[model samples]
Target: MSSASSARSGLRGRTVVVPLIPCPRCQATVRYYVSNTEDHEGWVFYRCPNHSATGCDFWFWEMEYVAYLVDAHFLVGNQAVDAVGATEERREELIRASYERRRIATQVATSRAALARPGSLQQNMSKHQESALIGLGAEILVLLKLLLGSVMLLCALCVLLLMKK
Candidate 1:
């Protein structure tokens, strides 16, 4: 078999197309390929479209790509795999969730910055300043609590889904 055919020997008619994720090197739609070699048989991975032609060596295991998606806010941590085959409504929901997460993160950063203002500690605190600081602290605590609760809930859901699987 030719090298390309040998490399894709593990793929069959049933292999589904992976969600589109651009190749970092070539700006092309990355292809999902399965490993046929003895050491990594059946392992699904993403790679640049035909390395010999593109001269792009972008490659990553499926799980690694999932993590990259999560970090880039393209997929939520809880829905990374499932989001691959998500429906239009589900994609919209994920987008909204991502937006909400980013909004909360921005709010937290702003509050933290306000609390760490320069010379706020070096000088004596006015009553108003003290109250503002107290308010900011309370807001931070609330945001943190919300974030924790969301994480716990996602964890529980993941456990339940795994059990089902």
Candidate 2:
């Protein structure tokens, strides 16, 4: 499939779940990879295996892809579709939620880069201290995701209850 056509597909005609999405271009299962490039060190993403040889350019940020599937009712495994409704209003809410997540992730990445720079405040800290701080940041990010997921569940339940009444 052409890149533009696949770009418009958005997980259509395929089963999707976290960490197991198929590449829209080559139909191959994508694997998570850490970016080693100077521009986006430590960032994770999915890349098609055919990208190097066959010129398939299917690449997506890991966190953003998860947010997209979870928010947009695209996650079909584990009975997720029933939990997340596919409606106009729900679609709008999902867009907002996804955007907020991306924004927060960008902020965290910026903050981390600033702290890790040479001669910065973090440079004065011991290696253990710096590692601990990074660990803490990751833990906080997980906690935030849990909180957001819970809130989304509660909202879905409320909508269902109202419909039943």
Backbone clashes under 3 angstroms, per model: 0, 0
TM-score of 2: 0.34
Instruction: Provide the TM-score for each candidate, comma-separated.
Output: 0.37, 0.34
Candidate 2 on 25-127: residue-level lDDT in tens? 6788666666776445545566787888898987766556555556655555563442233222334554576677779999999989888786675556677
Estimate every model's Cα lDDT from 0 to 1.
0.62, 0.62
**lDDT (Cα, 0-100) at 158 in candidate 2:** 100
Q: What is the per-residue lDDT of model 1 for residues 1-165, given as tens digits with 9 covering 90 to 100?
A: 123221222222322223556666777777767677644554567777857795787787665655566677766544554534332333355457667767998999997787789656443367668889999999999999999999999999999999999
Worst 10 residues of 1 by lDDT: 1-10
| Poorest lDDT segment (10 consecutive residues) of candidate 2 | 1-10
Query: Which regions of candidate 1 deviate over 4 angstroms?
Result: 1-18, 81-165
> What is the C-alpha local distance difference test score of candidate 2?
0.62
Query: Cα lDDT for residue 61, model 2?
Result: 66
The positional error of residue 122 in candidate 1, measured at the CA in angstroms, is 91
